[model samples]
Target chain A: MQPAVPLVARVVDLVKNYYLEEVVVRALRGITIDFAVGDFVALMGPSGSGKSTLLNLLGCLDRPSSGQYFLGDQDVSTMDDDELSDIRSRYIGFIFQSYNLLAQYTVVENIEVPLLYQGCRLDERTRERCLSLAEMVGLGDRLDHRPMQLSGGQQQRVAIARALVNDPHVILADEPTGNLDSRTSDEIMQLLTQLNRAGKTIIMVTHENDIAAWARRIVRMRDGHVESDVRNDRSTDRPAPAAHAAGLTASANSLWGGDPYRQPLGNDRP
Target chain B: MIPYLCLLLGFGLLWLVVPLAFSDKGRRSFVLALRSLWLHKLRSFLSVLGIIIGTGAVIILMGFGEGSMQDALEDIKRQGATNIMIRSVKASDESSTARQQRIAVYGLTWADYERMQTIPTVVRMVPMRILPLKVHHLERSVKGRVVATTADYAVVNKVQLAAGRFLSDEDDRYMANVAVLGAHVADRLFPFENALGKTVRLDKYFYLVVGVLADRMATSAVGGSSQTAEDFNDDVYIPMQTCRGRFGEKVVSRQSGSWNAEQVELSQVTLTITDMESVRPAGDVVKDLLERYHGTKADWAITIPLDRLEAAEREKERFVGLLFWIGFISLFVGGIGIMNIMLATVTERTREIGIRRALGAKRRDITMQFLIEAVVQTSLGGMVGLLVGMGVVFAGPWVSEHIFDMHRPAVLNVASIFYSVGVALLVGVAFGLYPAWRASRLDPIEALRHE
Candidate 1:
């Protein structure tokens, strides 16, 4: 990995307010954070805790009511919708929890959308790049299939391919593994881990601790405030038994991370 | 599938031409719009329904109207666009003294024809004397109108000769006992054998048939002219001198057991002007000359085809205006339909818009996508309308002749097709503006949160 990477995104005292009729709802309240290149960070918060709000602002999907957002050298806090779109297309890619793939397009088409918006010619070279990205996401054989035809996990992989196709500066994932079962989620997490290992800057939003633990660094939020930011040294804390299971691999955590698995999050629900 | 593909190709060309900073990116917006419409096939089709009908109706109705107008104009035009006719009225509505005269004569004379020729704009003048005379051809006898005129009569009246030849200058100069039989006259007098070269008896004289006329639609007397609406088919045409020599100026009529001789010289005088600009001047000159000669008799009336042509054009313009309004209303309704559908579509696809916005689509991109969808629908509708309109135009004449028995030919004007399609597209884009603006105004966050 490259050393002393530059900051990919930085937010200073960000605030976002929502107007519902005559009432006002404050989604994000004076939050400050910074992310560096090659950093795989997970954002953890409950519903209405403003993690989604911060993700939206970082994705350039919305402007903060106050304070500044800088994606690299560009100040995005005061930009208009068109300028924001330019920033997003240039520097950001998003992976949604529901896998927001357009129904009319096939897996290849969905993956090509961001590139298309970047004014990239969908020539033979562009098509090859798109196919290669699909292959990386393990969707090489499903290029012709539509989102509806694929299972939930496969749909998520297609979304992953889409996000990576543009080769953006950073990937913003809102609940990357929220809708998947344990086995599929592990597979997806492994793919993400490989991408991160390849030095991708991933800022993922998830309420699950186990998913958050997959990240090298974790940022926990509560009521629009950062509760804690810490590094998780899972290799030193966990047992090393069955690290090599000779050719048998049932899950991503087992095959990729050399571990069985743990249900360390969602136990606090209800 | 082809229509959808055609929509894409058309949009692709447009995308390249639009003033966007990034044209290829703009094309992606069109792709998204095309896919969205594909999602709701029925709705998109319904939205364009009004436009199709509007275009079809405008083309079809305009076709029939223009065709019939031209047909009437042609009919009047066949009378010669620059020709003006002056006919004798006979002064029939007068008191007892003139009616009881031995030879009541109130009409154009040979002297008037001579004077009419001297008018500045009068290029040619033809005068004719006609009377219903008993004609005999062997065993067949028919009462046919005998017209005595110069050779210029056939050219001025659009008379076509079937066989043999028309009256030459020599025939008129010599007062030759030769006649040209009209279509119906020949058909009646000599049904099987050819009428040309057949000797026909006119009044008390036997005349050789020099020519036979082809069948033609007889014209009606126009604009208060005293000329009667007579079918020239059952008439015998002879040289000017021949009738004057054989039958003289007096024809003895035996009606209701009473016999009387009415001396009539010239029945009608047709004058051709130099050009269209000379028609009114020529008509005025002829009227002035006749009024000076006949005094207070009111014995002549005039018909100018150029004046009729202008009147017909005015009437057609009014009819076209009416059609235009009706067509415009239909297109307006179609526009409204598109507006309503686009508004609903914007609302329905709010989440998708949010997703696209998040994926880096600018407000202008969103606006263009929606606008292009509306245009595609309308253009497709316009094409369908043009197709249907053409089909109706071709089939209209047949249906009119067979079922309605009204011989109206629907003529398609090339410009109308372009105009209708262009207007339909314009209306669609106009109506689409509101919805596109609405979609573009959507806040990305709020839209994403709109379920």
Candidate 2:
């Protein structure tokens, strides 16, 4: 229905099968999808729904067992491992749930990793770009800080800057705020919304309804297939910032240590 | 041979190094490896310890081996490669009647010395009469070999003079009782006073000391030849005529209830040929002449130092080869250590490999990174070992001379430096190949999932 928008990525009846201990798992069964430019799309599913597999395929982190995946008019489904890697480097940006920043590197250095793989010199222009990306993620003062030294929210911000440094065609975020307190999660969602408004395509995977509500379009997966596709009319109606302060204080206190999922949520109520 | 080897090594080093220095990705990988190594400084150092010890051992062992061989060769060289020595060894198969009568006459006689003078290649012949005698001075007495030879003996044997002059021909003609004191004898006989111008009694004959020889390293038995170990520092040199006049050919000693007399006119005849080419032929002539005259006695033992020198040279080649293999084996073991550490590093950094692969690093890039790390480690260890080995080589002689009171020369084979460093690089590449390949072949998704 969005014929006016240019398609950044399109998947046609894509299938991905995994062999685990002699059992062939149909992780993705003929899933068809299209992500348009500047679209904030959320892929939602329970565990074993193949939503993660679909995200992996869309990110070019894997090849489909069947069908074609077109990333900006190039069919990447049949590409080899090295070509897939190149596609990931040039066209796809991945934001992992664990904020997989290199432990040895500082903020600016981590953000410069993708460009380093692109064979770009760490010259004055490249350094300036990395510094600007760091500033964009609101970590201007922490440019020299390593991931271990930073709090969880700051580490995730570094990861976000790393994903944006290459100016990729699409940003694939898998559970962007899964480990954060609801307040920090909202803050991260706000950053994603701002990035989406600035003409960047974003595909995020989340199980929480509130996180999915932030996306303009929602694609739900079940049993290795897309169960439903819907558009949220009230996408602009964001949750109040201070509505969950009491629960936020409890989760924030233990965010540095202990299991994050066990912490109380700020907006469990309707 | 060494230059060609060095050239080949240079090309090989360039082959590995050019890409890393020129390519941005390669340079970044190098920096990353350096950072990773720096982070685990102690572990990296421990990992390379085997290489350090192995490389250092190669240089030091080869250096010492070369040095000692050179020293032995120098000793032979001092004896003159063109010289043939015929010493009188008592024949074991003397007649039973001669032994029962206590008169043994078996050795090179004065006639044999005179006959050897007929050899065409004989440039100079110094006949020596060696007498086992006891010398006494004041409260000191020492058993010493009294060498009665011409003044040519000093130059022929490279004897250094500490003080005074050697025995002149006039002293030999006049049969003067003037002698040259060996360093050991002089030190013992005249511990408090200068040996020159002093009198030391040898078997009841007081001989005036005309000279004192400086201490020199004694030549040991070489090439398992019949040449007996001679300590020149323990000898007392006297004139030939004076020795004959004082102690005649017939030396009668009164033992416990027995009288023994041994008749030996000349103890040794050292012949110097015109050049190295004539030494072997001259030696053959001497042997044949002695064999013809002595018949079944065969009392003379001919020792050509040139033969010993050649044998020693051949032995040195084999020794150096053996040392090379020892060094090779150690370096090989060191290489294995590097391989082991690299494999563990590949396993430990699986996640990093995944991250890099996700960022579009090619398999070759991963291989290059790990290979560079291995080479960097070995190269660093090799350089340090080289410096250490050279230090030991340079300092070894001085330490032995000062602390142990012994002379030990250490000649650094300059080629060993290049060999050690080159072999270190080879070891790195050889041993690092497997781990690097394994790392490059790792699946990115599987690696990312690793803890």
Per-prediction DockQ scores? 0.47, 0.39
For model 1, how does the per-residue alpha-carbon lDDT over B1-451 read when each residue is reduced to its tens digit?
3245336555754653464334655566666667776888888788888998999998898898788778877877888998998887767654454457866677888899889888988877888888888789888898898899899988898889898888878999999999999899899999999887889997678999999998878876554333456687988889999888888888788879977666778888889888998899788888899999999988778878777777777777787678778778999999999999999989988988887787877887788878877877787788889899989999999998999999987899776686678777777678888999999999987887787
What is the alpha-carbon interface RMSD for each candidate? 1.8, 1.5
Q: Native contacts retained by model 2, as a fraction? A: 0.53
Which ten residues in a row are the worst by lDDT in model 2 chain A?
A: A261-270
**Best model per DockQ:** 1
Please give the clash total of every predicted structure, in order.
Answer: 0, 0
Tens digits of per-residue lDDT, candidate 2, B147-166, equal: 99998887678789999998
Q: Can you write out model 2's per-residue Cα lDDT over A205-252, one digit (the tens) per residue?
A: 999999989998999999999999998766757553454444433432
* Model 2 DockQ (Cα-based): 0.39
Candidate number with greatest TM-score: 1
What shift in Å separates residue A262 of candidate 2 from its native position after superposition?
45
Deviation of model 2 at A268, angstroms: 51
